[model samples]
Target: MKRIFLAGLLIFALNVNAQVQTPAASPHAELEQVVGLTEVKVDYSRPNMRGREIFGDLVPYGAIWRTGANATTKFMIDKPVMISGKELKPGTYSLYTVPGEDMWEVVFYTDDSNPLITEFEEEKVALRTMVEPMEMPMNMETFTIVIDDVMADSAVLNILWANTVVPVKFNVMTDAEVMKSIDLALAGPSAGDYYNAAVYYLNSGKDIEKAKMWMNKAMDMTEKPGFWQYRQQSLILAKAGDKKAAIEAAKKSLEGAKAYGNADYIKMNTDSLKEWGAM
Candidate 1:
């Protein structure tokens, strides 16, 4: 039949031009959160050394480079996270990087759900540190992987390729263990991440009237709006003076922190509820 349909259309045009010339598949970078009900997922993979010349010969110093391909570079923690100081439960890890011209060796593979289950099993190490390489001389003709320094609690997990620079530190969960895991994740999930763990126990250093009773029971299981739990229960009801329910919860959290663009948390709740009678 017409030469078997021209040999199956020339083998499907050479398998779609060999998948459009292959190179271009790096993506699965992540950084999830939820420390109370424990749902931290930090899968990461970065493949960029474009202008080449990295580690002796394009990543060949001790060999074992799949660290940024199909798998390896994961860290899906869940509850308890206070590393380098103990308390490290709830797992799923496999993060490795051994690049060294100066310094870089950070492993932590607990191996699960397949990170090649310890590729060659370095005794399945659960922690192997040695970090420090933010060398600046700025050139970086390519290769970039980011996850910036976030801290309301803490975060930082970068690893830019050539010109090197590695950082990995994310310690979150502790305010009596996120208020006993947000009272066990508010009795049992509906999920807004435990209403952000009741607005992170009513904004850190908690205990403002038990964080306004867990921000009014996480605003009755969240419908959302509770902007900073009405600005920390209107500064704990204007620090007990109760300026009429703290100016009505600081005008409902300054209209929801100006509809959430959060201009510096709406000027700190309109300068602490309209400047407290300015005198």
Candidate 2:
């Protein structure tokens, strides 16, 4: 009987060994892409939510959360990111959160010292901001992350989960240094695109003269003074309180728009003139 038991134990051990497996890497992972001329690469991955009710339960309402499963959530930025006008340096940061019923506290932890565990402390934060989550029309079963409406100086960092929509405005400028970068891009290839970007930036309440300077450089390039240049120049003039100049420039821009057969530009020019109380 003893010998039979030994044989059975050996058989069970062999079976268990056969079933054991080793993986090549961690299951938690992300996608990496460089954005902006700064070449800031943002690496992100969707972790296993695993049927967890994100709000008011596992995360708990009115409390801070790391936002997802694993060690404090991480946002790896190769270049610095500006959050709500606050400057953050380029580095790997552990993201923590303060979950609430109406809103959520999004925090950036400076210490990349811990694993994806609830190990972060309040002292480790580099910057933090409370952002209200908007009620999403449709329920989201899985977590989603994306960068929307990217520009030369900013992009909207968006997160959707559990029927909630959260957006964080990420800016590339928080320092005098960013101005230097703008100057550099203005002086580089694709200067026209950079100039056009600057114009949009100013129109949207960003750097005004920076936009003009970029446009000047772009217009100087071999690129034709097409719809983009005309539209931006008109916008700058309008913003400068020159209604007549703006309207005239906008009309000229319409000429360029017609040349390109881009209805969007034509519409934008007409709509903008109206918005500026010009037309």
Candidate 2: segments with Cα more than 4 A from true spot: 1-27, 39-53, 115-120, 174-279
- Which TM-score value belongs to model 1? 0.24
Task: State TM-scores per candidate.
Answer: 0.24, 0.52
Q: Candidate 1 local accuracy as lDDT?
A: 0.65
Per-residue lDDT tens digits for candidate 2, residues 1-279, read 999999999999999889667852214546454456444433333544457776787667765565555445577776777787787887878766676777777888887755554544657778888788888897676666667777877777777777787887777743556678788878666765867587677858977767766765676673567776778778776776667877887888888898889999989998987886767
Which consecutive 10 residues in model 2 have the weakest lDDT in total?
A: 37-46
Cα lDDT tens digits for candidate 1, 88-156: 566877766776666677676676554453245766676666667777576555445555665645566
Error of model 1, residue 236, in angstroms: 45
